[model samples]
Target: MLHCPRTVARTIVYSGIFLATGVSTVLAADPTGDWKVADGVANIRVAQCSGNMWGVVAWEKTPGGKDKNNPDTAKQSRPTLGMPILIDMKKKPGVDAWEGEVYNAKDGQLYSSTIKPVGADQLEIQGCVLGFLCGGETWTRVGPPIPSSPSNSMAKGAPKAAPGAPPKTAAPAAPPKTTGAVNPAPAPKAAPGQKQAAGQPADIGDICLLPDIARFAH
Candidate 1:
């Protein structure tokens, strides 16, 4: 997610300290939300999917950008939107930070990375090449933190239709059996800013259900 070159030797000193101090924070800090990158070139939407943290490109300052620099020839023409930048980050035991690999689309390389929340509004990202040559930047929160989705909810709730295919219609359900007791009415939709009840699926358009993330969610 960081566009800065990893060859900068000066960043190692500060980044080393940053990574070290990040471990002191208490656990249970949530990082799910939209974040504005340091350079303001793009915003990433982070969410919990299949019990791990993943971030995808949600918005770009300049539209219609392609992943031209990607190493995979077949994917070079693909649009950058919705691409996963944070690759399956898992929470570090007893710490608030996540450890994973970050895909640097600018250079078509993946680096070992860690993301840590700095207070409630800032996210610190650091990446290292060969376990050194570290560099990072802080991303500011763009919206309120999202409540963590139930584990694997995104995958389970993901639409079954293939991309560009027409959606399938479900058959109508049979009439309920006649009984003295009446069936309870369905639960009301969760109001905005309210936490969803446990086991409830996320919205169909949730970023965690995107193909790039959904395929790896399980």
Candidate 2:
């Protein structure tokens, strides 16, 4: 959650628009990536894990912040970085938006929320308190667009190859025998300046891999 007074004020000011626009154009929407919040206070990394969309605090302009306002005393001392804000959101049918609960660390409350990608570079986040005090801001995309995660598809009942299954291609001819035991070939490494592939591990890696998001992965 964006724990800033300015952001909270904007939410109140734009509540009307948030309520009026129930859905936006569903243009090949894929919101999995790092996004800079409207206030530039933090970067939220969103990813599809276990068939659901989740986001977390990836970076903060002023680092080392704590969840002081969290109602649970046990979590008050926890760091805000990597905290789960966008809970288990499910894709809405025929729409390019996801609906779920958002955790507002500012007040330690959960609000009904929806996230919609506006174009390719902006993400609109709107939330309402008791379906009245609605407001949201657009987040700028800071990372490349990501595709559907394999784990997400698998969770959605997509078929997966069984473990230890043989390759689909025809078997290759046997190699000549060697005197000494042959060590397995080392894994390939990324080029010095190669960009990380979308949906693959990179800085902040997969948000779903985080402990907080994993709890709601199913």
Candidate 3:
């Protein structure tokens, strides 16, 4: 059946956000755990690889461990079930979540995935490739492990402020002194040939500079 485009778009956007930011107890360092595939067709071993990366060792198993999807009975030459299928990166820090692409060997289709830690011993995995084709599963921790360091880019420890305390303040400066004496300069008097007492003599280039202002104008 067809679905509304807006609803599908919104679902993908929200799903991406959740996948990108969800929390997990397991470090990106390793995936050493009992990962039950979301489709119930596989069981995976998760563990750490070099440099904080994750590795997934998968095995073919039906949802009920039946012969379905089993390479052994299916006469498949290779058991994709025991192969490492997921690569988790640790190159940059600040990644609070884990995401990857899900490859279906049967159809060669890749789906987007998100993993979150539900507890110290288990994780929640979600995978979705299309609008209505999403699935989820739970994984449990297993075996001895090499502790993975938090991503180098992950945010550091708490800030250094005490609770309920007013912030520190600096001393205020003193105001400047206002007392001062005032003095005024004397004004100038008009030059010769000037009609107004406030007016000065014209420069050599001006008609006003002529001895007879009326002759110059005529």
Tens digits of lDDT, candidate 2, 47-166: 777666888887666656799998889999998888898988899998889999888888999999999988878999999999999998899987655555343333434454699988
Q: Candidate 1 on 1-218: residue-level lDDT in tens?
A: 35455545558877888876774343226677777899988777777777778887766656567899998999899887778899889999988899999999899889999999988788999999999999999999875565553434544556565879985574597533211111222333445765544533222236665778767774
User: Model 3 over residues 29-103: C-alpha lDDT tens digits?
Assistant: 334444555554554544333233343333333211222342345433443434334444233346445676544
Cα lDDT over the full model 3: 0.42
The backbone clash count of each candidate, in order, is 0, 0, 12
Candidate number of the best TM-score: 1
Ranking by lDDT: 1, 2, 3
Selected candidate, larger TM-score, 2 vs 3: 2
Candidate no. 3 TM-score: 0.38
Q: Which stretches of candidate 3 lie over 4 Å from their true place?
A: 1-31, 36-42, 58-76, 89-95, 105-107, 130-132, 148-218
- Measured against the true structure, the TM-scores of the candidates, in listed sequence, are 0.65, 0.64, 0.38
